[model samples]
Target: MNDDGRRTTRMRDRAAGAAVMEQVVRLHAQAPPRSTLARALGARPIGEDTAPWFAGALGEREVGAVLDRLPEGWSVFHAIPVGTRPDASGAVSDVDHIVVGPAGVFVVNTKHHRGQRVWVGERAVLVAGQKQPYLRNSDLEASRVRGVLAQAGIAAPVTGVVALVGTKEVTVRQQPRRVLVLRAEQLVRWLTRRPAVLDAATIADVARLFDDPATWRPVDSSADTVERFAVIEREVRTAQLVRAGWMLAVALGAVAVALPVVSVLTR
Candidate 1:
C-alpha cells in the first residue's frame, strides 16, 4: 500500500500476484518470452514455491479489506513508514497498517502464519514453536508513531496490535503489557467496539499528520516494489520447503505405523 491512501488499490494489486506477477508479465511481453531470464530471476512453476508470498500479501490485503469496511469517521493507512527514514539503503521499512478514528489510533501488525498455533504472554509471543518478537516490535512501532504525532501537536492514544491471519489457534496465556493480540477476523470487531476516546475533529487532525511525509522521514518510493518482491520470493521459497519437510515427516510416521500393522497381520 502506498502512503497516499491507496490501500484498496494496493491490496488488489498484491492479491493479483504483485511484483512476481509483474516480472512474469514483463517477460511475456518480450518479443520472445524471456524464459531463461525469468528462471534465472528465481521464477519457478509458480505453484507451491510462490504460494507463501502471495498468501502473506493476501493476508495483509484481507486486513486492509476489513479496514475498508470501517465507518466514515475512520481513516485507514496501509504500509505506513514509521521511526527512521528509509534506512541506509534508501528503502522504506513499513508498518503493516494503521487505523485512526474515534476509538483512537491503532497500530495494526498483521502476521500471516497459516495453520500455526500462536501463544501470547505478557511480554512475548510464540508461533508454532518459535519465539517471535511481534509484540515487542509492534509496541516500538506504536511508540514511534505516537512520538511523531505528538510533535505535530496531536497526542492521540496509539495502541499496538498483532493480528494473526489464518492461524489455527490463538491462546492468550496473559495479555501482553503493551500490545493487544487477536485474530484478523476479530480485529475489526475489537476496534469498532472500543470506547470512543477521540472526536471527529481530532481523528481528522491525526489523519492529516500521518498523511504528511514529514511525520515520517524521507520516503524512498523508488525501488520499493522491487525490494518487496525480492523479500517475498525468499519467504515463499522457505515456506514451501518447510511444508515439504513436514509432509515428509508425516508420511514417514504413517509408513512406520503401517509396517508394524502389516507384520502383525502376516502372523
Candidate 2:
C-alpha cells in the first residue's frame, strides 16, 4: 500500500525495458543450447529471434536512463501495458514511457536503430530509407493514454514523442502532425523547455493516478526481471568483445603476411 492507502505493485526504474527484456528472455529460453565451441568462438548467444528484442531493450534502457535525470515535479512511468491481450507477435502493446510534468503529459515511444540514419517527415519516419510506423504508433499511444486519463477525470493534453536511440543521425524534414520526433539525447532538453500547462496540484494528482498499478493493465514484474536481463546483457557484451578480439587478430595476421611479401618483392 502506498501513502494514499492504495495497494500498488513495486515499480522498477527499468520498467521501460521490461517488455522487450521479457521477450528476450522468452526467446532465449526457447532457442537451442549453444555448443562449447560456439560459446568459445563468441558466436551470438542470442539468436535472430531474440536479437531484435535485445536491441530494443537496450534502447529503452538508454532512454530510461535519460528520463531518470528529470528534475523534481516530473513523474515518469515506464512500460505501461495498454493491450488487454498479446498481439500476433506474442507481445503486449505498451507505451515505452509516460511522463507527467508541468508541461502536461507525454507518451514516449522509443526506437533503437544503432548506427542507422533516421529521417522524420510530417507523417512518416524513414530508418535507413525504410519507412517505419513510428509516428502512427506514437499517435496511437498518446490517444490511449488520453483515454486512460479521461477515465480518471483528468483532462490534460497528451503529447506524443518518438525518441530515436543509437541512430547515426536524425533528420527531421518536418515535425509530425501530432508527434514530436527527437534523438534520445534531445528529449530531456526539449521536454524541460516546453511551457508549463499544469500547476502543482494537477501535476500531483496525475502523478498519483499514474502511480497506482490499478490504473494500467495487469502485468507481473519484479526485481528479478532486471537482474535476469543484466546477466544476459553481460554475456552478450562479453561475446561481442571476444568476437572483436578475434577479428583484430585476423586482421593483424593478414597485415603481417602482406608486410613480409612486400619486403621480399622490394629486396
Candidate 3:
C-alpha cells in the first residue's frame, strides 16, 4: 500500500474503533451547542446537565491527543471494548485508553474532575470528599488488558495508570501499589522517562494485536448510538422533573409558614 492508502486505512480503522464510551458521546450530543457569544458571556445552556459528560470526554480526548503525539515508537488505542458484547439495549463496557510503546503497555484510566480536590489512598480514592473506587477500578482495567494480551499469546507487563485532568488539588495519602497516578500534563514526561521494555518488533507485534477489531469483541455503531441518546434524554428529563418537584415542595412549605404568620398578624 502507498502512503495515501496507509493513511486512509488508518482513518478507516479509527472510525471502526469504539474508543469513547457510547453513553459519553450520547450525553455530549444531547446537549445544545453554545455559541461563541454565549461562551464569552460565561453562559451555559439551561436544562441539560452536560458538565459531567463534557469533563469526562474532554479528559479522555486530552490524554488521547497527547498519546497520539508520542514519537514514532508509541501506539495508542482509544475506547477499547472489553469483556462483553453490547447488551439488548446496545450498551457495552469500554476501557478509556491503552498505550503500547517501548516504555511498556499502560492501561490508562482517565478521571476528569476539574476544580475538585482528589485524594488517593493505597486501596481507595476520594474525590471532593466522596469516596470512589478509582484505584481499584483502574487495577481491574489493567488486569483485563493483561488478560486480553495473554489470550493473544503476548506475555507483557501491563501497568495501571490513572491520569487526573484539571484537578484543583491531588493528595496521595497512601500511594497505591497497583496503580500509578499522575496529572495528565505530567504523563508524557513520566512515560518517556521509563526504561525501555519493549523493542520495535515487540511494539509492532503488540500494536497489531490491539489494532485488530476482533480482539475487542462485538462491534457497536449506529444502532447503539440511537439507543444511548434515548437513554440520556430520559435521564435529563427525569433530572429536570426532580428539580421541579423540589422547587414545588419549597414553595408549598413557604406558603404554609406565611399563612400562620398572616393569621397571627390579623388577630
lDDT per model, in order? 0.70, 0.87, 0.72
Worst 10 residues of 3 by lDDT: 3-12
Residue 80's C-alpha lDDT in candidate 2? 80
lDDT of 2: 0.87
- Kindly report which residue pairs in candidate 1 clash with one another: none
Which residue segments of model 3 deviate by more than 4 Å?
1-21, 24-50, 83-90, 221-267
Q: Which rank order by lDDT, best down to worst?
A: 2, 3, 1
Residue-level lDDT tens digits of model 1 in 1-267: 456644333221222223333333233233243266554444443444335545656677778777778877888777665545444423345677878988999988888898899998898899987899897789989988888787888769999998888899989899987899999888777888999999888988888777765555444333345455555457448656766776788899999999999999999
Score candidate 2 by TM-score against the native. 0.94
- Candidate 2 lDDT over residue span 131-187, tens digit each: 998888899999998998899998798999999899998888999879999999998
Which of the predicted structures, 1 or 3, would earn the higher lDDT when compared with the native?
A: 3
> Candidate 2 regions off by >4 Å?
1-14
Query: Which window of ten consecutive residues has the lowest lDDT sum in model 2?
Result: 5-14
What is the C-alpha lDDT profile of model 3 across 1-267, one tens digit per residue?
A: 333332112311442123443555654665677576654443444324445554555578778777766777788887777857665434566778888889889998989888999998887788998998888889999999888888888877899999998899999888799898878888888888899988888888889888876676545334464355445445545656666776788899999999999999999
